[model samples]
Target chain A: MKYTILFGARSYEHEISIVSAVVLKDILKERIQYFIFIDSKGDFYLIPQDKMNAKTFSTGGYEKYPKLQMTKGGFLQKSFLKEQFLGVEVMLNLIHGSEGEEGIISSLCEFYHIPYIGPRIEASVMSFSKELTKLYAQSRGVKMLPYHILDKQTRNIDSIPFEFPFIVKPLHLGSSIGIQIIRDKKEMNYNLDVAFEFDNKVLIEPFIGGIKEYNLAGCKVKKQGEEHWIFSMIEEPKKGELLDFNKKYLDFSRTEKTTQAEIDTKWTERMQMAFKALYHHCFEGALIRCDFFIHKDAIYLNEINPIPGSLAHYLFSDSFVSVLDALAQRLPIAHSPQVRYLFLSEIQYAKGK
Target chain B: MKYTILFGARSYEHEISIVSAVVLKDILKERIQYFIFIDSKGDFYLIPQDKMNAKTFSTGGYEKYPKLQMTKGGFLQKSFLKEQFLGVEVMLNLIHGSEGEEGIISSLCEFYHIPYIGPRIEASVMSFSKELTKLYAQSRGVKMLPYHILDKQTRNIDSIPFEFPFIVKPLHLGSSIGIQIIRDKKEMNYNLDVAFEFDNKVLIEPFIGGIKEYNLAGCKVKKQGEEHWIFSMIEEPKKGELLDFNKKYLDFSRTEKTTQAEIDTKWTERMQMAFKALYHHCFEGALIRCDFFIHKDAIYLNEINPIPGSLAHYLFSDSFVSVLDALAQRLPIAHSPQVRYLFLSEIQYAKGK
Candidate 1:
């Protein structure tokens, strides 16, 4: 019953992850047995029992803690540490943005055969990418705003594709970090410059007028040994225009207006329909936070957060811990059985040679 | 001026990778200083200088070769080896399929800051997934066949979107490892069972009759410090009625009818048009191999091999060494600069707290 809560990584949302960790620590305090923090530069830190606090996580100068490298084994390794095993049974991944959310960390977990509590590598990677997510949504005939990709080499700000009054964002960043709404031509350069600082590639999406933003969180639970996904009541964040970094982390409690439990059945049905449609096209991870923009009859899948903050804890019943515990009980459910190569065999090599 | 030719990993195409290494050895033998082979189980073996022949590669029992692990410093480390530093400046990545081409090893290279000679992690991952690749193509108006995804949990062989005469393939495997043509409903279960052996998710694409198969190899080189992509003269493989695993590797040399230097500008223009369009989206890395199907006026992107066989050596010049040298000189061309933070600053954190 060992649990290691992993948080913090090299992302624009580094401190936000720490905040998410603080929230997680509060909810799953009795459950978590160990803590690991990844620095902005991608260094692993094992927090000692005495140093485990919200302040310690926020500050993140864990020079005294043991630095780790993930081997084929699931547990943390310090190359030459006196103690070899840390007895990590399940990894509670609270990593937010960039490396952590973008499937790199999840892939690392997969390569190491660790049971991580989020989307699989492919899902994480696809969800983290705005371009890929939009494309998948588009293929599935999901409503989406017109978007254009501007690469550093071929296309740049000098050659903008969309008209002004467009939203430009870094292709892979989360929590609306490098995002700007260009109202006019003059604001284009500055917005593009700011966006490029986060990612070399930026996605220019046409801004729709009279749009309402709604966030719906989804979770997968096992019922009668079969996977059943549950959707939460939709929340409309009061944050102006866009849910920027400030609105996401700071003064976050008043961020969204959400119902406590069972809302209108029709509303729930529509939300589930949207969620299920996006899920087939690759909106994934164990706990998923999908945002949509509704303008009259049109509903566009705005984006998906694979590693949603505190695993989108507030959306579940009572707290995120309730759903997390349910999901955690089915640990390593996603783990593929031993790969039996259909065409690959050692004896076949001898014959082929 | 150290060059280590790396090949073999846990893929159904493991033996095929060894054959590809043989092809690479013929082309890059003069420049290659060391050779490393990764067995199917992901064990690293430092191939002894003497035991570097095709016979050795085709039959992999390198138990005596020193085991190696990629360190954070971007060099191979063996805990028991006499020499700690391998002095690996540039890596020639030849490992095929799953672990090799799917960004796991590429990310390992990225994490270590090693100059891997292939598509970077993002491009590799995107190209590795058939569903994503097709979706991206669909987004850009790059014509593709009608396809549906069948997940392990949701859909079974009984439920297929495409009508009879469809192709069932493992979504992520390469070299036609788990692929079958389901000509009728009777064969659907068998094909799906076969496809699922290689991957949990399978892509069901409408099989096009009387379609021409073409292989186009693309290379990226630096001239006057400016990036230029070079395309190979098109080849029409003779491997009829689905290029199966045996046809792809064993009798591969005789499969293609490729014009050596120049032919058909109009045709090349059309092929290059498709290649360049895909490139603009994600046709990345030092080298890329894209397969296409053209039936009537319709052209569809079939699949992309991030690390094509022989490094797609044959498609380039008389030898791959020429382009490898040109690309190696521009070591680490894919590195990016600038990391903008939306929030999560230490000074800002202190103030917020």
Candidate 2:
């Protein structure tokens, strides 16, 4: 039951990833055989800590940690470490945004023949592309907000079908980094420039009014050779007119605000069924989390978080340690790539690594 | 420039891939610096031949070639060889079908920081999933034949909206494998059973009648500082009611029987624009080839070949060797992952030797 814990990339979520990885390492400190931190520049480092807190990354002088090298054997090798977790039984991937979650980490693991927790490359890539998710989900009757795609090549703002107060989002960004509510003509160019800074492709959609957001986290649990999708108690977060990054993280943790609690059995049943349908549509993932907006009793999906922050550990009743252990063992089975598309080994690749 | 020519995989397209690789090896014999081959079981080998013919792979006993290892440096290294492709100026990838074309090879190259040809993982995975491709392309107004998706969980064909004389294709397969033309109610279950063998999900669509097929090859050619997509001579191949694998490869080369030649400049211009739109929507592929149906004077895409067989060399009057050399140089500049995602060092990880 060897484990390799990896996180902290150059993404905007770098700090959040650090916090999650350190907390996860503390929770599963005894079980982990290796802890590797990838810097914003994609450099691998051997963390020299037995226990970590939120401040460890900054205070611990992590830059002093020896830079590690990859071996032909697929192990991240260092001069001092006796166990590198090269051929570990599983990789507990805690990476959040960008390449970390966008199939790069999973692709690396797949290539090296190590089973990884959560989604595989195809699922990660699919989730990373929000428009693709909408198209696939809408086909299965998952209600979604009306949206239009805009890239660098897009010239006409007049062509946008949505009215003002529309939200413009960089297609590939995570969190609310480059999202802006364009209220009028004067606001259009500024928001477009802001979004263009983060991503080449952007998505513009009508901002739903009176939107109440609900977040649900779930896992694919395997038992007795059969699989079941088990969801946790849903949480509704109270938000400002818009949940900006500052409001999301600085004010308080999004987890603490429980504006709405408990999900209806029938609604949960319908959601699990839809998720299973999407899963069967060539995506492989586990411990899935989703955000939805309930406007006038009709649910519109905000996004699917394949690898949620803190792994959404708070949602499950099981101890976070137990969840990590079980996930390390079970995620691979649920993440199996079918022979449907000339099935080959996973290690897909680290995009924009 | 040092060149590494790679191909062959375990997928159903294994033999076709070998034929392609062998032919490519012969065409670029004088220029190739090294040759590598991957077997169906995902094994890699070093090939010594300076030149290879179409017959080489079956008679090559490539298994006898030295088993090679991938270095952390992204070089395909073997002890006996004078040098590995570590930091090769370029890699001419001619792999077809399976992991070879499905972004795995490209991922491997990407992880090693080598810019290989064809679509990146996002596009490859998108193209690999027919349902996803349809959803993405149809949104861009890419006229596609009406189709329905039927997964293993589907209980009844009676529920399908498509009528009889439907073509059932496994969602993930290529090269026409596990495809059946269901002409009647009696033929439905058999074809469903046939397709289910290849993929868990199947696409059922009414077989378009009088479907005249057109195949066009194009590349993401760079001229001046601006990039332009130039297409090859469009070829229309006569079909025997259906262009199954047998009709596609074994009977005769699909290239020879060109029933229609010369693409209307206007049609090619429209197709290129559609392709560029698809590309900007996060697809990164060069040397793109597409199959289409001209019905009612409208274009309908059947599939997009990211790495067309033999790189669709015959379609272009340019020398095949020169195309490979030029592609090796220009592909990387056009393959940047954009700026919004935290910029990380692209050399992420190389797992499992």
Candidate 3:
């Protein structure tokens, strides 16, 4: 079975994606058939496994590699008289931020009929937008902190129903890129201006000081003939006003060093139940980490990381390869809605009405 | 501007998409630079303008044309020693169902930085799924008919809170392909089975008998730095138990003959306001048709047609070419989140953490 690792797209988290892919290369080892890197210009390049390192991409040394063209199902390397098929039985989406979490790679995989290991387009859209995530959580009966949206078009601050000490986040960004904590009225305008630089919409939520935040990663996998959820032990992340961009960067770059959070059995069960409610039907195939805030003995969903950095390998107990293998075998088959063209066939035979 | 019309992907509404593209070809005439037809196999073929007819695609005659490759930004034709760029400045999404409304083509356009005249990925995802659309409507404070979802995995009918006389619809399908009106409890199982054949999930809503249904189409256009909504005259479609697959197919095939619905000004303003709420920031730059049900003087959003058949040309009075040109000029510029790789560069220089 051939597996392709796709990473490094035109995103703010391009370097992080490279780090994730590099970490994955060490984990997946010889199972990977191709390391397809998408440059900032959105061109595909086939990087040799031996040359897979941070320097190769950072120094733009990947330009010398064979360029690949995206065809119907998979990529093709155009050379001399024939095009070479970089056979990909399954693809692992390791890109982060915009192109990855926001549904570009998912769309590419779906359009080309390539089975991939990541959030589907619908899940990506539902999870990527901080604004939409709140709606989805509400619909699922998953509790979320009350929030207000400030649009760049209107820039209306009066619409906020809550008091001061708010957390301002760019609506569609990941990796804590454009997040600021506004302690009072004097800090609101400056924080909003910073968030508007990254996205048109900003999500302002009540900043609960020293909130209990837990990160749990899991995925629905099929074994034998039945499907069920495989959940990871929850980790209590160190929190501040928020983990700033640099801290989040270092956190995402860490590989395989994980410690489970110590919590009561009842609380763990309750949090897991909330995760199930959010993950069940919408986020079927993707491996995701849901960050939750335990507020006043009630669980509140902070956000959904559709494409978690390094695929959240450290969270789960089993080896990433085995989990990925089982998932790849039972990857959701896209139902090809059979088109008989019965209507068109009948129209061709009939005369003008 | 080099305008491209992309249509027909492995969708149930493939023929309807062809009909829509043909109608568009006639309307746009010489303004169309290329008509890229995607066959059921998800392959791209450049169909000649003269040969653009129902018979051409039905008889599989399009296979003879030069095949095109989907590159980063646009399509390319490879022959001899060189690849010719198709030169697409803007593209019009004409595909109808799965591939189009499901966010595949939108993702392709977005990833490649091709300015297109259709719904963005977030809008497509919100509108494509009936269940998600309900959540989105609720989030926007738009009224929707109460509904329940039936999943294929659980096949749970016991969870439906609604009584009989329910309308069962496949969650992800357009064109009214697998919709059934259940008048009594006995018809529930059969109707649900039929709807499940089209999609994994089915939405059951109370069938409002003879509901005052109206179709409204519109888009947001920017002119001289001012952005405003351009709404078309509301349309009152002929109602039935439901327009089953055949009637709906015929309706979608019609072109350029429309009548302004004799709706009262107050009702018109209300419906237009609802349309504005649904379309404002979420569905910017795309021309869409929203079908609404007016019951008890309250407008309930039925569903959103992200990529309407015939581009809903008849709904709007203006020529689609001019509307498309205006939209193309002001198509939302995807904010490219800049990455300096300052952290990664620092990591390369640092000896130890």
Candidate 2 error regions (>4 Å): A41-43, A48-85, A246-283, A319-353, B1-3, B51-73, B76-85, B153-155, B246-281, B319-353
Per-residue lDDT tens digits for candidate 2, residues A24-137, read: 664556778777787655667777665343433644356676676544334655454243545456677777777666777776666556677767776787678777777867
RMSD of 3: 1.7
lDDT of 2 by residue, B106-190 (tens): 6666655666677777777777778877887887778888888886765467778977788998887777877899889888787
Give the TM-score of each candidate: 0.88, 0.84, 0.97
Q: Pairing residues by index, what is the TM-score of model 2?
A: 0.84
Q: Write the per-residue lDDT of candidate 3 for residues B1-353, one digit (tens) a residue.
A: 66799998989899899888888887788888899999988889999999888777877888899888887578889888888988687889999998998888999998877878899999999999999999999888899999988888788878988877788889999999898888877887787888889888898898778788899988888888997678878899875768877788878877756888898999999988899999988898689999999998799999999999888888876655677777778888887766566766677778452
TM-score of model number 3: 0.97
Cα deviation at B300, candidate 3, in Å, is: 1.0
> What is the DockQ ranking, best to worst?
3, 1, 2
State model 2's lDDT. Answer: 0.66
Compared with the true structure, all predictions reach lDDT values of 0.70, 0.66, 0.86
Top candidate when judged by TM-score against the true structure: 3
For residues A214-328, what per-residue lDDT tens digits would candidate 1 score against the true structure? 7788866677888678676687656677767676776332223246434456655776787887775344336788887777656778887777777666666565566666767
lDDT, model 3, position B87: 67
Residue B317 Cα positional deviation in candidate 2, in Å, after optimal superposition:
2.4
